[model samples]
Target: MNSMDVVRVLARYRFSYTNEISLQDQIEAVFKYNQIPYKREHRLSDSDIVDFYIDGVAIEIKIKGHPVAVYQQCVRYGSHDSVKEVLLVSAKNFALPDVIGSKPAYVYFLSAL
Candidate 1:
């Protein structure tokens, strides 16, 4: 499948359970399915604590609500050269507030970024 198709397939995996599966876990599963080489967080610096670190890319996933603290954490953790990219994965209707600056980023809905 193409990249878009792959993203769509990944989007469908999002579902709410009593015990919710984390966004990093879901993204890791997708990466595994696609045979994408990745390494989870193996370091514990102040700026290294996040959901997942795939191929040195720091990804912070959020659900529907806009948590200011979480967004700030992602920005701070992602502000390093070791981090290739900082991505915010969210549900279809997730709205971010204006406090966060316009940085290099991507948003994925039920479709590709």
Candidate 2:
């Protein structure tokens, strides 16, 4: 599928009613609901394992506080050859970092999700 398809699946999760649950688990349920197969803790490389691998995109969840450290993770995952894009999801809203470089990276704040 395409990136927009992934976006739609994520958007569906935003309107879901699973409160007090982790965004990571909510994302998984979204995939299951959409019948979109995904891998959890996917091994991108020997040194890296992302939270979720949906199609060619690497989705890393960071709910618990948005720190600059999370962006560091997005960059690291974006660098992997196996991943064509990276989506950084967080419970707290955070602005994308400047100089995140030319990677197909996107950020989502889960407060509305």
Candidate 3:
């Protein structure tokens, strides 16, 4: 599906959660609706985990204005040897540097990239 379709799905999920849904859940719901296969990382003590992994690509979903720590954590995960790519899907527009068109580990905005 196109990027706008992805954004629409995320917006729907955002509206469904009145009490603040986890970022991972929001991302997973979008992938689920699109039938994109993915696996969720599990952790007992962590408040955040890489939202989804699909075909070795780790995607971290965040709403606009999420803390800097969240972005850093996603960057860390994306830098791992096991991760082929890392994508940051944001709810609002933001600037991102070019990644040489790499398959994974590059950040992307939901509506723009």
- The whole-model C-alpha lDDT of candidate 3 against the native structure comes to 0.54
What tens-digit string does per-residue lDDT give for candidate 1 at 50-84? Answer: 56566555555565545666666666755666665
Candidate 1 global lDDT: 0.54
* RMSD of model 1 against the true structure: 5.3
Tens-place lDDT per residue, model 2, 11-112, is: 655544344345567778888888888998899888788988887788777655547777777788877777877777666676665334455777766665
- For residues 1-113, write the lDDT of model 3, one tens digit per residue: 33334445555544333222455565676778878666777331244456666665665665665446655666566555556655667655544433413433344444422
lDDT of all the models against the reference? 0.54, 0.71, 0.54
How big is the RMSD of model 3? 5.7
Ranking by TM-score: 2, 1, 3
Reference-based TM-score of each model: 0.60, 0.78, 0.55
Candidate 2 has a TM-score of 0.78
For model 2, the superposed segments whose C-alpha errors exceed 4 Å read 14-21, 97-101
Pairs in clash, predicted candidate 3: 85-104, 85-105, 86-105
